[model samples]
Target chain A: MFVRGLKSSIIALESNLKNRTLFFLLNFVLLVTVFIEILTYKHSIALEPHRYQNFTDDILIVQMHYDSETPYTFSSIFDRKLASIENVLYTQYAINQYIYNKETYQLSVKIKGTSGNFIENYDIVDFYYKTNGLPNVKKNELIYGRVWTNEEYQKGESVGLIYEATAKTIFGKSDATGERLNFGSHSIKIIGILKNTDDIKNYYRTFNNYNLEFVVYTPITYLKSDSLIDYSIMRSYNNDILKEIITNNISEKMYFYEREDVISKTLDIKKEQLSNFYYVIVVTLIICVVGLFQLIKNFINQMTFECSIRRTFGATKFEIFSMLVFQNSFVFLLALMLAIVVSIMIIYAYFYFSYRYVYPYLSYIDINIILIIGIAQLILTIAFTTLLSQKIINTNIIDGVKGNS
Target chain B: MYELINVSKSYGKNQIFTNLNFTIESKKFTGIFGESGSGKTTLVSILGMLDQKYTGNYIFNGINITQLGDRELSTLRKEKIGFLFQESYLINEITVFDNLLLNVLDKENKQLIKRIRELMDKFAISDFLYRRVSTLSGGEKQRVALVRALLMNPELIIADEPTGNLDKTNSEIILSYLKSLCLENKTVIVVSHDEKVLKYCDIQYNLIKNGKLERCL
Candidate 1:
């Protein structure tokens, strides 16, 4: 009996191909819109942790600038006070130089002097260094940043690495670890090679808008005669007190910048984007529901005579209502299945060509969310269709049979 | 048997029937003939339990139909009364066989299938069994409608202008079929304006002036 009813419904659906096609197209658009919204929401949620990974609530960046009147040992004065603070974690200082010239090699490049814990604190990855095949660095030793790896180089008095772009610019290859270069009076031997110059460029672009390619890192002890720190990066349990302390103790010529402020601003922008997507989803859902209601209503009107005939043929009111519901539910289920397939294909294609780091974040497309949305859509459709069918069943059978009402 | 006592039906200010009393017995072909606005259709609608708004004591066999709820009325309609409309109200999208078996809950019952086949052969619609009803002529559609009406073997078959759309020859064929149903101890009530169709009824009533039914034959 169920099969018979199903067969009759299929016939009815086939006979009204134009209406069914319109319904399918409308529902497909709705499902795809919903799927895209869900995908973006999931992507944003996945990237939330990574974006704020370095910007812990308690961490702060304090940039200090000095002039001729300022003391050369300005950073050392804060070191004692910062360590004495109750919630202070640790502080690392850095000095930047853009006028490093190697006369023999004719290479002028930017360099940075960093403290020992710089790599661990900054969350840098793919760091490699070797002094004559011994992968370690000591005080005053140089570490060359290479974009890629190549042949091994012999150890020298000072070990260094060059960025891949720097190697490509001078040696015509990405791997120039075996080469030696001079920085003023110092001859630096290339030791280690870093893998991704693009990552370094992105990091520098995000923080200070400085060009990061071809930059070199050396120990802060290397700047013995010029002991002026450019920036200080630190982590603490109480940023509020630290901010206040820095504001009070800093000289008139020095300025302080906090990392937490930058993260908060970026998160505000992302939150705005998420809210905008939600608005679009809600509006689209409204349009979908209204359009679906009209479509189902029109279908019921067209099937009035059929319903009346069924009622006359001993079909109870519920049976008449169920037939219409079953027919529409079948169509909706088919449309939903097609929409799911299309949505998955679109999402996979987008992520496949995007950045590698983005791939990990795509894993947050929650299956439970999809199921909830699908079930909600199903329930919503059924509710409206059932209401419409009830109205249809309540219509006078004689009027329906005559197609007058 | 069905009886209506002091039955009155009205639509707002327009009255269709007032203080009408009528009785229809089993095992007979009864026809109710009237003019265009004489409420012939309304009378049969009430008899078939399709309209429950009329104030009356409507008894089907021994049960008070007016006292029955909508569900009970629906069950009574399903089990005891068959309805046929002038439009031959068939679902045009399905085949003739499906239309005939529309009311049968069990489509795979061999006994029902055999009965449907015999009726199809009797009506000479066996060749159009798989044909879409929309593609059939008016006469063929009415025959299919008749088969569907009789599919459940209801005790009372109420047809409103069942031959109103048919030509003379097709009209006689349908009238003869209604008459044959009387031989099986089933009551067939037909409402029509056609004099030729009226001549075939065993007993006939004319709904005349002031919403009254007068026995004509």
Candidate 2:
């Protein structure tokens, strides 16, 4: 009886493939919204860690036009105002350039030229761990060597970290921590080794076409100048007065945003997108629910004669209702599977084409959101189906045989 | 033997039966003739045990149907009776063999296959074994439905308007096959208004005016 009834249900599904396809496509749209929101979040965070707990709301990031005339860049006014902003916990500089050097190093690093200013070009980030943490990792990554000592950060040391693969190719071993590499006039010592994971390689894809994360960690003082400073970050103490001072000083050449300003701006856009998605989800959910109800109504009405026929052949009400439940539940399951497969394919395709690698983006996914949506969808299906099975069981066999609803 | 004693049924305010009584003997042909909207369908349902919403003592094989629950009633119906409706009642999208597979006690029983094949051969429907029910002509479909009705090897076959959709030649063929079943010690009860069908019944009843069951003189 189970096999026979299941077969009939499958035939019913196959006969109504158009309705089932519509159902699957509606659910697919809902899942796409969630996945696209997740991808957007990944982009907003510079695509490294899932959580950015260390970047508190009070920290201010100042950006200025590099190579601007005198007193217009952070390397001038901002550097001179450092002492006045008292009780600030930490201050850092971001000065990066791409120098296509053909020396023994093949390095993309730029440092103090003969004029004590950075040479401008494209390269990886050179940052010293201001919190005395390992600069090799962003959040949850593990690296090979050690973090910088307090003395190294305070004394403006010229030591740096290199990727393990880069160290292997240039210095003959992966553990060449003490080895010195001459860049133009400097012989910076390698102090640590980045783990050289695929995530780091994806990070390199954002900058140059090189597949290596040739990052070097050094003190901010090593690359600073009174000329060009890419950007500067500092912990807040008296930032309001400092902002007033800086705005009054360099408002034409620079802009400053606190962590709250940046995060709120990203969140505002996300909220708008998500609210629109909520409407789509709600509308499609209404369509899906109404569609299933109407489908079941028609199914029961059309199958009334057949149900009576089966009943006359000694089929129980239980058997008939079981067949109905099996058919509806099967369609719901098929739709859910369709959504999962399509969403995964879309994410993979986007990453593969855009970044040439999908490894870094994988680390930024919040799977709980996806699972919650999936489970919620399943619950809706189950609830709607079971609620309607009563109508199926209660259909009058006498009326049914006579072709009555 | 089957007997209905002091049976009464009603729908809200309108009543279908009030203390109606009847008896049908085993291994004999009984016929019921009624027009549309008459109480013949109600009586058929009561005797078929497809309905139980009535006050009656319906004794079938010496067991009262009123004392049975749905499960026991379903079991009794499935194991003891076979029903042949007017429309053939077979899934048109499936093959004749698959439709027959729905009626047996155990679908996997090997002897059941032999039994089905034997019955199909007896009815001259062996050629329709793999054909979808929808593709067959009306007469062919009715023959296949007859073969399905006999799969459970039940003692009684209740055929409700078994030839309503058939031409005269095909109707005669179905009625002849049903009448022949009584010689095999099978009790056949057929309900129809067609004079050609009710003529074959040994004991015939008429309900043409939608009233109490009255024996046709």
Q: Candidate 1's residue-wise lDDT over A242-278, tens digit each?
A: 4444445432213322222344566688888888887
Tens-place lDDT per residue, model 1, B95-206, is: 8877766665335477778878888899999898898888999999999888888877799999899888999899889889888989999999999888887678888999
TM-score of each: 0.66, 0.67
Off by over 4 Å in 1: A1-25, A41-274, A350-360, B105-108
Q: How well is candidate 2 docked (DockQ)?
A: 0.41
Q: What's the true lDDT of residue A67 in model 1?
A: 16
The i-RMS of every model, in angstroms, reads 3.1, 3.9
lDDT of 1 at A398: 77
In model 1, the Cα lDDT at residue B191 comes to: 91
The root-mean-square deviation over C-alpha atoms between each candidate and the true structure, in angstroms, is 12.5, 12.0
Name the runs in model 2 displaced over 4 angstroms: A1-143, A147-267, A346-363, A366-374, B104-106, B208-210
lDDT of 2 by residue, A1-405 (tens): 677455556555543455555655655565565555554444433332212221121111112122223221222323423332211112211111111122222222232222111111123232222233554234324366664565665565666666676666555478878877444244467777767665655543432233332445554444444222223322233456445444554333333211123344555676676666566556755665566566555555565666676667777777767665666567656666676667667765666666544344454455565566667766766676566666655666666767764
Per-residue accuracy of model 2 over B1-217 as CA lDDT, tens digit each: 9999999988798788888888998988899988887877788888988778889799998998899886787777777888877878777776787777655423546788888899899878898898878799888888888888888888899988888899999898888888888998999999888888867898898875535888874
* lDDT agreement of model 2 with the native: 0.61
